[model samples]
Target: MADSVIEESDYIPGKDELDWGYEEGAEWGLLFPEANGDNQSPINLNSREARYDPGLLDVGLTPNYVVCRDCEVVNDGHTVRIMLKSKSVVTGGPLPSDHEYELHEVRFHWGKENQRGSEHTVNFKAFPMELHLIHWNSTLFNSVEDAMGKKNGILIIALFVQVGKEHLGLKAVTEVLQDLQYKVTHIQHMIQQYTVIFIFVLQIEEFRRLRSHVKGAELLEGNDGMLGDNFRPTQPLSDRVVRAAFQ
Candidate 1:
């Protein structure tokens, strides 16, 4: 783990002997029993085993993320997070018509130089990095904190990241890593990494528009690495059915 990026509370040294329960450990069950539950996330996505449903074709995502110049970014000891202050929303996409979810925050996980860091895997193949964009069902919940642990209260969009040409949409945020180097977590003290949201706006708007035309699997595909391996091991997928849309 990078001492410069992670908070002392959330930092653990070796992957072979991880101290954090959020990683590979049994202690997680003591805090979040759901960690041992059947519906835990970050499961393996086996394409061959997934069920194709024509009806799922209608399940879509319509995002309305606006450009903002005054958004907040923080190093929450766990991950670097960017809070979306705009009333950005994602409709459809496995949600009921009445369930409208608003963008909450965006965070990422990455591994060391040679290690794969993605939380979810495709056929056991890990990606170098992953972006988790968390959302809350605002139509049903008054606040994101109130929706925690509630069924159908939260929605997380995971995107595998690949390293190649500089991602224009990620530049604005990533360029500020130097400023946030070794920043500790202070819930009341959220340091602003960037004053502008150019790349941030581009990323959300592009993905939102692309979702209406592309299948979920395609949109979620890619492989890349970033900082030290910060991803949790893939959890068991008990009684969970992987569904996808097929033409």
Candidate 2:
């Protein structure tokens, strides 16, 4: 997938448009049919209920993220997003061995308060923020636009964020928030080790890091230099089974 910044023209009426907020997301299904799909994401990850798939343990989720010096960070009127200019790919785990998913963009979802920012919750517990690393099946499609909406077309790795000692890897992004506070304006800079560190922490570090913190809420200044809560409400999991790689 080629590195591309999100433009106002890329907004679909009911999909990527900024007409809606977290409060108005419930009505999205009425405008966009895909919002009501059975396999919708941001579901509550019930750890106790999630069945441990031993297969995931065997295959393991592998990531090959490289530093992107030509990346651009943009505030698209809703959230802060980073467009990847380098080719970073991941394979194995739940994905099919025949295809490799290429990282395209990284988006941050935050809230007005720390207690409820993350899109996905754990045992009904919400986190301060959430990070979404979006990827497309590069082996099967030419671009992210071509792969979207197709079955097994996209894969997103969601990571919950909590308050802690300052994260050196994310400092570069936070420092540039002032420059990209307005919509469409972006800063071209190197996002060094941001992608690699997060993926590594998620897959290898302690899972308890996801727990909420008392000081976690005010992590990032949103689009307009305020606490912008840009996230969709949790969707129904329906018949989907969330498989876990660990026992």
Candidate 3:
């Protein structure tokens, strides 16, 4: 938790977090209880990067990650799984428990270059690498960092590197290069750690494509909650009023 560490005061959720999901929105409304619920932005979002979150880099990246070791140009290979070495870190959440859970595993995600570094960031700073240390919020000695700093003090770390000069650790993840559809959570097959091998990484275009596909598909399905009403939609003004609301 070296990188994951904060003074305990930085946990405040941002406006995006406050306006985030339905559950979060419900909680947020309790405070600004009378604030306008109406949304005017395209797609009802207040901003473009509304869903892009740094915290997601911890939880949303693939967990049941697999890697490859065989390669021609640079030791290319298929996905081979590496087991996570288990040990505890500091654990203290809303409940009891000294040591949370152990360091689950490590992975990586890189881009073609620096300006587009990795997908995650802290305070908008982009480094050569963005390491992610995944520990159970539920485990701990001292806190989670205790287990995190044990080795390199960085377990479940994310290393961001340039596209050139192949990486040895990444061979474990990139080998399974084929992008098959992932329908369910991959944690149960978590090798020696949590359910994932490692991220093979994606280009900026690929990322945008993924986002578009997801958004388009979600809209097509018309999730009942997002759409609000499948059975009844607002009628044209003629049906509800003698004239219009102002008229």
Which candidate ranks first by TM-score, i.e. highest?
2
The TM-score of predicted model 1 comes to 0.72
The order of the candidates by lDDT, greatest first, is 2, 1, 3
Write down the lDDT that model 2 would get. Answer: 0.65
Ranking, TM-score, top scorer first? 2, 1, 3
lDDT of 1 by residue, 195-241 (tens): 22222333332222211111222322432211245567676666667
Q: Candidate 2 vs candidate 3: which has greater TM-score?
A: 2
- Residue 120 error for model 2, in Å? 0.4
In model 3, which runs have C-alpha deviations exceeding 4 angstroms?
A: 1-101, 105-114, 119-129, 137-158, 180-247
For model 1, how many clashes? 7
Error of 3 at 145 (Å): 15
Provide the clash count, candidate 2.
Answer: 1
The estimated TM-scores of all candidates read 0.72, 0.80, 0.32
Flag the better candidate by lDDT, 1 or 3.
Answer: 1
